[model samples]
Target: MVLIIFFTSLAGNALMICLIHWDHRLHMPMYFLLSQLSLLDMLLISTMIPKMAADYLTGKKSTSFIGCGLQIFFFLTLGGGECFLLAAMSYDCYVAVCHPLKYSVLMSWPLCLRMTLGSWLLGAADGLMQAVATLTFPFCGRREIYHFFCEAPTVLHLACDNTSLFEYLMYICCVLMLLFRFALILTSYGLILATVLCMPSTDAHQKAIATCSSHLAVVSLHYGTVIFMYVRPKTYKTTNYDKAVSAFYSILTPHAEHPHLQSEE
Candidate 1:
């Protein structure tokens, strides 16, 4: 599973990057955003999976304080970045389908670059905040982490004091990271679906539906696991159930970015 996850995500993201670079036709706002998503997913999974592989093979299930802190930081950073990038992709789809004529004007290369940069900056800020907040909590010398890798929720579970402040910050970040983008993706697709059905030509409608549908599919899969993982009130200390879900997003979500980009061809 480790070898599979590493090579597949690496190849998948690498291919998406290659496609955007070599194919001039893909040098547009949509594919550009995809390239960013690919890059972010690669980084996101890389933060968790390599450590997990080593732990599985070596039977070394423990991470040092520094290692755990850094892992949580990078995981949140990349994951948050992808959240914003996906939202950007959804909006690009919205404009391309619902405002085809203005897509060129509205989503120019400069604007797209700016949006991507903004997503990265925001993600970094959130990651830094959450990392500090989480790690500062008193752990009461508990060292064994039940999850496969360090995560905000898993890490916070080890805290010995009232985590109300950290939990509030976490909920706010989750709302911004998942729900905000979710609402945008849903609104874009709603308008997209209505517009596509009203189009006069079958071919034109089909093409628009295909594009919007791909983005919607990704949104559902990515956010479904994300909201399930984070947005709820903390429940169990650790469960195979949570680990399985986290593993899916960590392993497969990056893989999904590649085929979706390929389908555009």
Candidate 2:
């Protein structure tokens, strides 16, 4: 099942990348960021799922300390990057709809590239901080992480020493990085709705609403799963349901952002 999920997601995202790269009409800022998003999702799922599937199939749960840290590092980095990227994408849509005159100038190639780079950098830095703080703590026993991947909360639960400080710090970072981006996304959509209401053209108004609505659906799935997985207390035992939720955002969202659909719409 895990292997099935991994390959399916991989194929879907690969197709998205191909479509985005090959289609000249999909060369706008929105699709450009989405292509980058597809790439990020590919990397994010590739990092964890292949190994996890292999381990599950072979019944070998063992992972080196360094390997575990690397898993957490990539997972959080991509996760945070996706959050910001989604928010950035929403902002792009808002600009395109609300400020059509300035849309091209504001979301130029250089600016889009910078936003992409900044999202990755910020996410990496945040992930690094969490990984360092997590791995530095001593683990006397209970090496088994409840989840398939090395999630921070689950990994922290395995530690021998006190983790209250680390847990609190991680929570703080989650609030800042994850919740902050979510708030910005919601605010952008709210402003977008307000702007769309004033537009007289029914066609333009409907299209604008459709775009934002699709974006909101994606955002809800991505952030909802994440908040459910990570925000709660560590002692909370992870269920198969939790794993399923994680897979949705980690795999499904990128598929939904496939370039073919973007171009058609």
Candidate 3:
């Protein structure tokens, strides 16, 4: 199952990148954000899946201290980047649909490049903070992480010191990514819904609604799972059930979006 998920995510994201690269028509702001989304997913799934699969199969779950730290950093970076990318994509959709004439100027290549660069920088900052907070705690020789991956909550539990600061910081980061951005996405789509409804023809309204619905579905899949995963208290421990939930969003949703990407193309 792990191998299947890894390869499928790899292929699906890679396909989106290639299609956008090869097709001139798909080289717009939306597709550019999508290719970055694909890239992030590839980096994200690669960070944990291979080691996780090996651990599960070989029963060697021991991870080096430095390895765990890097894992947490990369995971948080990509995860946060994914959140910002989705928000940017939502705004792109809003601009394209709400103000079609100005979209070319507003979401031009330069603006798109800036947005993508900003997303990565913001994500890296978040990750660096969390990594520093996480590693600063005394582990007291604890090393076993309950979940398949080295998640924030799981790692924090190993710390022997007061985790209040790290936990609070994590909650803030979670709110920024999953909650705040989700609301922004919903707001963007709400405007899209209203705009599409005001279309002169029912066919146009339906077509616009269909497109917005697809993006909303992907957004919901991501934010819903991540919110559930991260919004818990600091003392939260990982269960196999939690790992399963993480696996669902991490492995399944991007592949599901493959069909939508193809249809849009």
Q: How many residue-pair clashes does candidate 3 contain? A: 0
TM-score of each: 0.91, 0.89, 0.90
Could you tell me how far off, in angstroms, the CA of residue 260 lies in candidate 3 after the best superposition?
Answer: 11
lDDT of 2 by residue, 1-265 (tens): 6677778877877888898799898888888888888788789988887887788789987889899899889988988888888888988987877777777798898989889998899889978988889999888855676677887777777788988987887777787777888898888889988987887777777677677676678788888878877776666745676667666766555345522112111
Candidate 3 local distance difference test against the native: 0.79
Top candidate, metric TM-score: 1
Q: Candidate 3 at residue 220, lDDT?
A: 86
lDDT of 3 by residue, 148-241 (tens): 7887777887888898876887788677667788889999988988887777876666666655667778888888888878887645634776
Question: 184-229, model 1: which lDDT tens digit per residue?
Answer: 8888788888887887877777678667666677778888988988
Question: Cα RMSD to native, each candidate?
Answer: 3.0, 3.1, 3.1
Prediction-by-prediction clash tally? 0, 0, 0
